[model samples]
Every structure is written in structure tokens, then in C-alpha cells.
Target chain A: MSGPTVLLTDAAPAKAASTRRSALLGGGGRALLGLLLPLLLAGAWEIAVASGFATGRLLPPPSRIGAALWSLAASGELWTHVAATLIRVGLGFAFGAGAGILFGALTATLPPLRWLLDPSLQALRAVPSLAWVPLFILWFGILETPKVALIAVGVFFPVYVGVAGAIASVDRKLVEVGRIFRLSPLALARRILLPAVLPATLTALRTGLGLGFLFVVAAELMGASEGLGYLLVDGQQFSKPDQILAAIISFAVVGKLADTALVTLTSPLVRWQDTARETL
Target chain B: MLSLQSLSKTYADGTRALEAIDLAVPNAEIVALIGGSGCGKTTLLRLVAGLDRPSAGRIALDGEPITGPHPGVGLVFQEPRLLPWLDVAANVGFGVSDLPRRERAERVAHALERVGLAEHAGRWPRELSGGQQQRVSIARAFVANPRVLLLDEPFSALDAFTRKDLHRHLLALWEEVRPTVLIVTHDVSEAVALADRAIVMRPKPGRLDESVALPLRRPRDPAAPASEAATRTILGALDRSLRPRDAARTPELAGGSSF
Candidate 1:
């Protein structure tokens, strides 16, 4: 038994390495193929335009989009709109995340409070953020309030649902362990439940940030003079697709930045996730 | 320092898991609760751990009846059940936060060292192998320096080699701390190997069937040939309990060799 076991053990590692090498090669090949796809599509689009199968106004070339990006950067107009959009989204996210997490925790812990608050909140959540734009204009009269409110509404639900679900999903065994350790209810919640749920809440925060960016653009499109969304509208009316494409590229860039920042903010809490995924 | 007076449990679904059971575990003694599937061994362990309430009985630790989980009681479940978000050291220090920070760090380090996992302190639950994870669970239980440690089939999921290694390590740890231990297990060999006194339990409205004092001495070598005789003896008793007619008729049997 020992001899055969020794033989198998010695052979297994080599077999495992070869298999892993082949799997990695296959995965890398697929990744290279995926990277080439967007360039292929852009090249095809340019060819179609050259062949007169599509008009330049209908489908702008990648080169034109690049030129628009350079022009916007040179004029400093992109920076102005980007800064305005960032401030609004930041304020909306901070307010919405704070309020939503507080109410979500209360609702999750107290059944009576949940019964009173959840249905109304669910109804509020059902109304699209854009639908609230007109209502907010009626209330706050179309300044920054409507835009911020729209983004805030977009931001709230994800964080609220995330916090509540995280709290509810805490392991009963860990709670029991806390009880055995004689931890107070507050202590248990702080030490065990809070830490356990933080990863989910942070993930929700990242997702909410992305949603806020999307809605910031949408809200500006509906009515605003100072944001990337407004830039898109201005570009469309003036027939400057370059400016439109430039605003869109800037939006994508900002969205990526916000995502990266949120991930950085929550990195410490999710360090375990990083290490676990590292092995694979 | 633990006593159960007429401890019985009936599930909400009307199945009686345990019925009118009386048990006492003296301080620092390791008692193994052994039985087949659905025999209420886990129920007994849970009741003692205060994870569940008895349907119609009382459990007391050192005289006072327990209404809820008592402090200084550590429990290790079948699965490691380590919180996925925590590293090995954090998982071990999970319940010991009341101590000073320096002392907590020392205790966490010591516990991990005791389990031979000091090198793996920064690893997450997913990073470690199953046996290593279970060892971390054991370290978590022991880190509290609990007065009463209850293990419910803790090694059941492990392979035979890892299970044996853990049994030896557990006994070594028990000798050091000497908490009142009550282990629940279905494997007769495991019960016989680790226990000082093995209590056989009957299934379906479960009750204590027989209690046998292990003939093998403390710090017995699990790999030694001398241990096999004692193993056979315990297995023989377990075999008798498995026989349908005799188990139903007698309900309690001792000092009989069925094999």
C-alpha cells in the first residue's frame, strides 16, 4: 500500500502541472481572441463607410472619435463638464449611501419598522430615476436638485438591499459562538455581523457608484447646462458628433475611475478575496 | 461540571430525537457519545452546547440550569465553518476579543502554533486544505480556553489519515487544557480511540444504551497493534447494537460479545 501510494504521489504532480499548463494556454488564447474583437469590428465599420454602404454621419470612424477626444481635451471643456458631474455624483452617492444603509439596518433589525418602511421604499424604488426628474423639477425647480436627486435615487436601493441582505445572511453559528463568548448584542453585531457583511456592502457601494455615473449623464441630458450629459445634448443640437462622442468617451473614462476608486477604498476589507482568487 | 436531568428533544415535525436522557460529564473528562445515524448524538451535543433547547428537560453546568448558551463553553461543529471573510488568525481570535490586544495576539499565535499552522496565519479559509481548515476551527475553539468543549462529529468529514492525526492532536491538546469534553461520533473506532468512557445511544426516541470504560490507557498509540484489540472489543459491542431484533428487545446491553 505504501509503495503504490508513493508511486502515485510522485507521478501526480507532474501530470497536474502539464494539465494546468495546457488549460492556461487555452485560456490565454481565448483572451487574445477577445481582445482582437473590438478592433476587428471598428476596422469593418471603417471599410463599410469607405464602400458607401454606410454614411459617415451614421457610423463615425474610430479615428474621428479619437480626434474629438483630442479637441475636447485641448479646449478644456471636457474637464469642466467632468468636474461638475463628479461633484454631483459624489454628493449624491455619499448622501444616498449613508441614509440607505442607516434605514436598511433599522428595517432589517426591527420587524415593525420594516413593515412600516419597506413597502413605501419598494414603491419608491419601482419608479424609474428618470421619472422622478419631472417630479423633482416641480419640487426644487430644476437647479441641481433634480439631477442630484435622480442620482441619489439611483444610488440608494443597491446599498440598502445589500446592507439588509448582508445583515440577514450572517451565520447563525457565528452568532451562537458570540453568545457562548458572552458578547453583548451590540458587541456581537459590531465584531461578527458587521465585519461579515462589510464585503457585500462594499460591493454594493461599487455598483451604486457606477449607477450614479449613468444617471448623472441621464439627468444632465434631461436638463442641465454644465455636465457631460449636457455636452452630449449641446453636441447633438449643433450636429457635432465629435463632441457627442468625446462626451461619451469622457463618461466611460470617469465611470472607470469611480469603479477603480471604490475598489481601492474597499480593498482592505476584501483582501481575503484577493488572496483566494490569486491561487487560481 | 455538566449534568443533564431527563433531557429530551422533540422536533417541530413530531419526530422524537432524544427521550428522557440523563448524563453527567465531570470536569476535564472526555466522554464520547457514540451511535449510528439519526441516533440523537448530535442533538445531545447541541443541547449541551446550548445551541438548541431540550423539549422537556433541563441541563445544568456546575448546578445552575442553562437557559441559553453559557460563557466558557466552546463548540466545534462537523464542518470547519470558519467565516469566509476572515484570515486564519482572525478566525482564531474571533471570540477572544475581550482580552487585551497584546494578549489576544499572543493567544492567537499560540493557538495557531499549537495546531502547527503558524505559517498559515495570513491564509483565508479557501486557501487552506480541508484538514487545515478544520484544524483552524479546533484552534478557534481552544483559543477561548473554554471550560467545556463540545465536539459534534468534528472529524467525520476528514479522510482516515487526517482523522487519526487530528485525534492524536486533540488528545494532546486535551491533556494540556483538560476542558470537560463531550464528543459525538458515529464511528465506533473513533469513539473507542479517543474516549475514556464511551456511551452507546439508541435511535428513534433515543436514549442511553450502554456505557463501557475503555480498557486502553491514556496516551494510547493509535497506530500500535496493542490498540486493535481494544478497538475490536468496542466494535463488537457496536455490532450487537446494530442487530435489529436484539437492539429492539433489550434496549440496554453490556458485557456481551456479539461477534
Candidate 2:
């Protein structure tokens, strides 16, 4: 069970070298592992439809879904829908997260501000995501404003909660370090408060983004004229199962890519975090 | 010189942590504050470091009043408290950011070298062991060249070997900068090894019971006859400090008895 010291020393560098090399290749390999289940299911459905085991009317085959997506892309209809969805999410996230961070910072640092706003905000947060859709439409009317507002509402609460909660839990010991260093208030916020809240802030942003995607679907389903949500509505009205499935797949793909982009962009900021996530 | 004139701290919750602590520490002297729990040793250090305000009286450093955290005063906490976002060099160079870029880099390099963490300058605080992190914290305080440095049980968490090893690094750094130190420690051996004068305190509105001046020279051995004698003397002061109020009379004030 035990290796000699000489043998252990000889094996260590070679093992380390191989593991280092595997790390680069392992990411793609891991991604492929994630695709395995979906691909298997698609393949099984394709064979089932091809063999005429069941009518592919209500539940379309993978081939029919791909064809529907391909035709939409060939005419550039897919890009229009994708762009519309992306614009709505981008605008909503930017507005919501900006206000969230600003208000969160204010409430956390000033006791009076916290006392004034925290209770009302907490009450507003109890309102469900979909429950606000009708109210937002009534407030902003049947236009882009309502859709964007809906998505913004979805993004705001999580970011606000994350920022406030993170600030609340920042280590007082670290703040005392700032005090001992004689950091000015601005310097204290810059050096301690900002970096300390970053990991949780990033998590909140990601969660808010996910909720934005959810609300974007809800927003588009109601009155969107040209979006993936619209495509869902169109397919349902026309009774085209393949087109609906294509829109669903597009949503999954675009949402996942957007999430990956977010993660990639913010990854460097929290590289210092010694999380258990790194152990894997 | 650092002077505390009748310094007292009564918490808002009605606990008088320290009562009328008056002391003057000359330049470059190391004073170890030793006592049992609730002795307000840490509170006294905190008040001196200016991290907290004393309810009564004031502190002066070189005739300058210290109302808050002063640039001339530094503190080492129980934990390292190094900024996790910063590397070892950056953390050590934190208080000295006002220096020119070249000078900051040079000073950080020098401080890292002093702590024997020169090679690990680029490593994050998380990568270092408890002892190494504490050493970086020590370097951080010393690199600023403060006139007074306060350490609140900075080595209580370390293993005995690491603790002894750190004492050497601390002394080496202390030799260079010669900051007046007020270290709060429970270890009698630590006080004996580092402190030029060990001060004992009694709890319940902590007051100074006695101050034992050590006559040992530089690089004193904890096991040496003079060091052991000093340790035993300070220990005697500590024992008498915890006794009932009337019985805490200094019966062996002039003696340095050894077993």
C-alpha cells in the first residue's frame, strides 16, 4: 500500500505534468459529458419517429425540429428573434442591476436609509414574478417598456438581496484592518467593501440574469411580435410542434451561451476565492 | 514615547473593562500585557491602537493626541486579517500605498524578505499557513514604520514550534524598526521571551496589579536562568493579580524568586 520515497519522488513530477495537460483538455471533455444525455434522447426520438412507432405530430422528431430552426435561420428570422430577446435581457439587466447595487450600497452603509427603505422593499419583494406582469403592462402599456420593465423587475430583487446580504455579512475583522490602516471612508469602500462583496454580487448577477430569461419568456409570450417567445406563440397558434420545439431549443442554447459569457467575463474577479468548487 | 493618562473604558452594556490605566512606554521598549481573561488586556491594546475610544482619559504618542487610528500607530490582530484579494506583497504594502511606486515595491520586497516570505510574495493569503500569514501581518505593520505597534495575542493560534520561530522573526524585525510594542499575550513564556517589561492586570474593571521589568539582553533564551527567573517573577505577579481585591497587595514586589 505504501510506495518507497524514491519511487514516490520519481512518479510525482510525471503525474503532475500529465494532470496539468489533462486540465486543458478536461474542460472540453467535461462539456461533452454534459451534452451526452440530451444527444442520447434526441437520437432515440429521431429513431422512434423514423421507425413510425408513433405519429410525430404533437411531439416532433429531432430532425423536424432542426429543419424548422434551419429554415428560420436561412431567412434570418432566427437572428431577428434572437436579437430582440438579447436586447430586452441586456437593457433590463443593466437598469435593474445598476439600481440594485446603488440602493444596496446606500442601505448597507447608512442605518437611516436602511430603516426607511428595507421594510417597504422587503414587502414589494414578496410579490411573485408573474404576478407583476399584469401590473407592469397596466403601468407601462402594451409596448417595449412593459416587457423591459417585467424583465427588470425579475433581475432587481435578487441583485438587491445579494448586495445587501453580502454587505451585511462582510467580516468586521477585515473592516478593523481598514481602520488600523487609517483608510479614508472612500478608500475603505474601495479596498474592503467592494472586493468583499464581489463573489456574492457575481452570484446575484447570475441569478438575476436567470430570472431575466424567465421573465423575458413571460414578456414575449403575451404580446411580442418578433421574438423567440413570439415564435412559441406562432407555433402554438399554427399547431406546428416542430417550430415550438425549435424555439425552446433556441432559448436553451442562447440562454446557456449568455450565461457562459457572463461567467467567463467575471471569472477573473473572483479567482482569489478559495472555494470548495475548486477542489473538484 | 507613548503615554496613557488614566485610561478607562466602560462599555455601553455596563461592564467596566479597564479602570484608570496609566502607563508611559519609552521609545523602542517592548511591553507585554499579561493577565487572565476579562482582564481588559486586549481592550487596553485596542484603546492604545486607537481602534476604540476610551470612555475616560486619553492617549498621547510623542506628545501627539491619538483620537482615532493614527498613521504613527499600527496593530496586529489575533487573526492575520490580510486582504484576501491581495497577494502577500500587496497586503504588506497596504498602509504604505502613499509612497512612490518604486519605493513601495522596494519596501514590499524588503518586508517580504524580512518575514522570509520573499519567494511567496505573489501567493495569496489563503495559500500561506497560519504562522506565515501572521508573519506577513507583522511585516505589514512594521513596513509602515509606525512609532507604536500593538499586538493582541498575535501568536495564540500557532503551534509551539511556529510560535517560537515567529518570536525570532518578530525580534529581528523589531530590531530593525524599533517600534514600541504593547503585546497582549496569555503565554508567560511568550512575555518572558519578548517583553522588556511584563505588566500584570486584575479583572473586573481591570487595573494594573504590577509591572515586572526584565533584565535580560537581546536574543534572550526562554530557558536561560535570567529569562526563567523573569518568567517566574511575572508569573508571581499574575498569580497575585487574580487574588481577591484586598489580598492582591504586592508582598514580593522587589523579589525575582526562581524555583
Candidate 3:
């Protein structure tokens, strides 16, 4: 708030240096504070196991969980389960996203299509994806088909709604400019509509990935033989807590990898957005 | 040449925009329609552009009845309205979608060079200054090589210096292209400086209030000694037209005024 004259004075450098030092020190203190709770929980868990209040078989120690992960890796069972889950999720997600984009675009561009489909879509989105698991199993049997169908249903609605809303909300001024230029309907959709809706659709893609995880776990819990989700449920049934903990860790790693893939794929399309928001 | 004969427009809510208006735009002449806000200046331009149909009357271009947007009419709106996703070159070439890819690229490049933005062809609208983006919009209209150019307050958003510079650029382009132009603006000085004929309009069942023939010398300088007198005369006429009916009787005007 002071004048530029004061900012340029001899004392300004010393004041600025002290401010920087204190801010760094404060951040270090907060980091240590954040670690205290996690450290205390780990310590108590180790103590409880030693005291025999909870047996190692029922509630495994952190070291036991780590050993279980290494053993699973050595046997190749962990990799096989992870690959199976990924294939199911990937195939289901690809089909769901493609269909969602086509239907969403069709509804947005044609008023008659929108009027016909909007009510049914609204009704479907009301039911949670898990609710469809039973019906999917009944229709397709307790095979891979049921699990894949559940994941697809879960992924579809968010992507469809996101793309449709983005298209419908496109700036009217841009459309007028298109008209002045005499852009054909296909050209207008490709150049004007698609680019405008891309940012929203990208966000929806991420949301669909998350829903795919939920449906995958639900499907595995009910019926499945060889997936990360099945491993977790199987470990629980056998009272082997170490195996369950290892499965959970692998699930988190898969999620992080999927997220990284999407981010890498769309980086070029969103370069403008990153530059615009650099100051913030 | 372009002509509007008894051209009229009424909105869906039945608000009449223009009525029984007649004007002839000869080849290579610039006509500026000046008016208070919502005096059907834009509506008239839209009607001429064939964006909206005239409720009554006819518009003709080059001896043919105009049923839709005239084939070679270039329109620049109040806002630059460039596509945010596109850079300068792409924005300029937007109106020439039918041209082959190679030809479109050549036209876009040429138009950008003409607008003095050859080096800025890769810059987005958000990346450029306001005046620069407006220039790209001007380039867009020019790239189409229109027979008649219609403008709606195209430079009203700019500062004085930018506006003046653009005025020069517009005139230079007009001289080269020799398109019949109709400009709608609220600034009286802008009208007097750019137009051979200025039409003043009034709102509330909007119609033409007055029309004046500008006598300022060719290639008129806005800062010249003669231009100041022209400015005041135009301003006085505008003041009389704007005044309440009771105060409009003391019309001490100097310019040739017609309706």
C-alpha cells in the first residue's frame, strides 16, 4: 500500500528478505503439523499388534501388507488381476464414451431428438449405477458381460450430459459469425460446436473414469474370479487382511495411472487454458 | 449499386423497426446513417444484409431482387466477434469457407498483410489488443471481396486515436475496393468525416429525422480548420433533433439539412 518511493528505499531489501524467510519457516511448521496425526496412528497400530489386542492375521501390520505385495508380485498373480480389471474398465469406458458423445451431439443439434430423449435420460440418471448391477446380472448372467455392462452404464450419463450442456450453452454470437461466413451444418458442428464443448467434455471424461472404478468394485464384490476388486473381497472372506491391503494399494496405483494417461492425451488441446490461467 | 425501396421491418412482438424508407446507394459511394440509440439503424442494416426479411418493400443489388443476404455484402458488427479459438489468419479467412484449402490460405495471408497484421497471423483474439482484433475483423470482411460493405458502429468501442487510425484504414480499403458502403454510427463527427450523405434518425416508431449532404473537402482531415465548423453544424443539427419538441424551434443551424 506504500508509495513506490518507499518501496525503492534502502530499508526495502532487508524488509523483503525477512518477509520471505518467515513465510518459508511457517510453511515448514505446517508440513510437520500435518504429519503428526498419521505418525500417531501408525505407532498405535504397531503397539496394538504387539500387545495382542488384535491379531496379525485379522488386522495386518504395515510391514506385513508390504511383504504381501512383494510376494504377490513375485507370483505374477497381482499383475494378472490388475491387467484383467484394466481391460474390462478400458473396453467398457471406450464404448460408453463413444456412444455418449454421439447421442449427446445428436440431441443437442436436433430439437426433435432432444424432446424425445431428454425425459428418459433425466429419469435414468436419477438411479445410481450400483442399482443396475442386479438387473445387469439377471440379463447377462454372472459373466464378464454383466460387469462390463455395469461399468458402461455408470460412465455414460455424465459424459452425455456434460457434452450436451456444453453444446447448448455455446455463445450465440459465435453462431451468428458462422452464419455470416455461410458455414455448412457439418462445418459449423466440427469447427464451432466441438471446440466449444471440448473443455467440458474432458472434465466429464475424468468423471466417467471415477464411476468406472465404482461399478468395477461393485461387480467384483457380487461375482467375479480374477480382478483387483475380487482379490480384495476374496481376502476378506478368508480373513487375510494383508492381501486385502495389497489389493487396495494396487487399485489406487491403477487410478493414478489412468488419470495420468488422460492428462497427457489432452495437454495440447488445453494449452491455451493453461497459459490464460498462469497468473492465477 | 444498392437500393432500399419502402423497406420496413416488424419484430415478432409487432414492434415496427423501419417503414416506407427509400435510399439509393450508388457504386463506390459511402453513406453513413447516424441516429440516437435504437433508431432502426442496425435493423435497416440487418434488413439490407438479408439477415431479417423486410415486412414490406424491396431491396435490390446490381439490378436483382435481394431475397437473402446479398452475395457480395460484407458486414462488420459493433463487436469484432472473432472466433476465440482461431488466430488472426483463420479469423480473416472465416468468410471464405467455400474457397479451396490452398486458395483460402492465400486469401487469409493476403488479407492479414493488408490489415498490417502479417506477423500477427498466429495470435489469438484474446492475445491481441482490442484495436488489433478489430483490424482482423476488418480484414475478414475485406477477404471476401464484397460488392457492398455494411458496418454497424464498427469503431465505437475504440479510443480516439485507434478510431482515427481505423478511419484512415477504412477509407484506403474503400478506395481500393470501390464497394458501395452503408455505415451506421452514433457519432456525428464520424458520420461527417466518412460519409458523402448522413441520415439522422429518431426513435419511438423510428423513422428518418433528417438527412444532410457533407461539404467538407475530400480526404477530409478531422483536425483541420474547416472540419471544426462542420462538426459544430452537424452537432447543432443533432442537438435540435434530440431536443424536446418545445425546445427544437430555435434551430440555428449552418449546414444543408434535408429529410
lDDT of each: 0.83, 0.90, 0.82
Q: Name the fnat for model 3.
A: 0.25
Which wins on DockQ, candidate 1 or candidate 2?
2
**lDDT: worst 10-residue window of model 3 chain B:** B247-256
Q: What is the DockQ of candidate 3?
A: 0.40
Q: After superposition, how far is residue B232 of candidate 2 from its true place, in Å?
A: 1.7
Q: Mind giving the per-residue lDDT tens digits that candidate 2 earns over A135-186?
A: 8888998789999988888899999999999999999999999999889999
Model 3 lDDT per residue over B1-259, tens place: 7988888888899998887777777898788888888779999988887778899999999888877765688899889998877777888988887889999999889777777889999877888888888888988998899999999999999998999888888887788788888999999889878987777766655666556777666799878876776667667666766765554443222243642
lDDT of 1 at A143: 82
Worst 10 residues of 1 chain B by lDDT: B250-259
lDDT of 2 by residue, B1-259 (tens): 9999999999999999999888889999998888988989989989988888999998999999999999999999999999999999999999999999999999999988988999999999999999999999999999999899999999999999999999999999999999999999999999989988888888998887778888688788877888888877888878877778775454332332333
Please give the RMSD of candidate 3 to the true structure.
4.6
Interface RMSD in Å per candidate, to 1 decimal?
2.2, 0.7, 2.2
TM-score of each: 0.86, 0.93, 0.86
| Candidate that beats the other on TM-score, 1 or 2, i.e. the better one | 2
TM-score of chain B of each: 0.91, 0.95, 0.89
Give me the candidate number with maximum DockQ: 2
lDDT of 2 at A63: 89
Q: What tens-digit string does per-residue lDDT give for candidate 3 at A1-280?
A: 4677776796789989998878866878778879889788877887888898887767787778889999999999999999989988997898788878888888998999999998898799899878887788789999899898888888899889988888899998787777676677888888787778887788888888888887788888887899999998889888788999899989899988897788678867755553642332
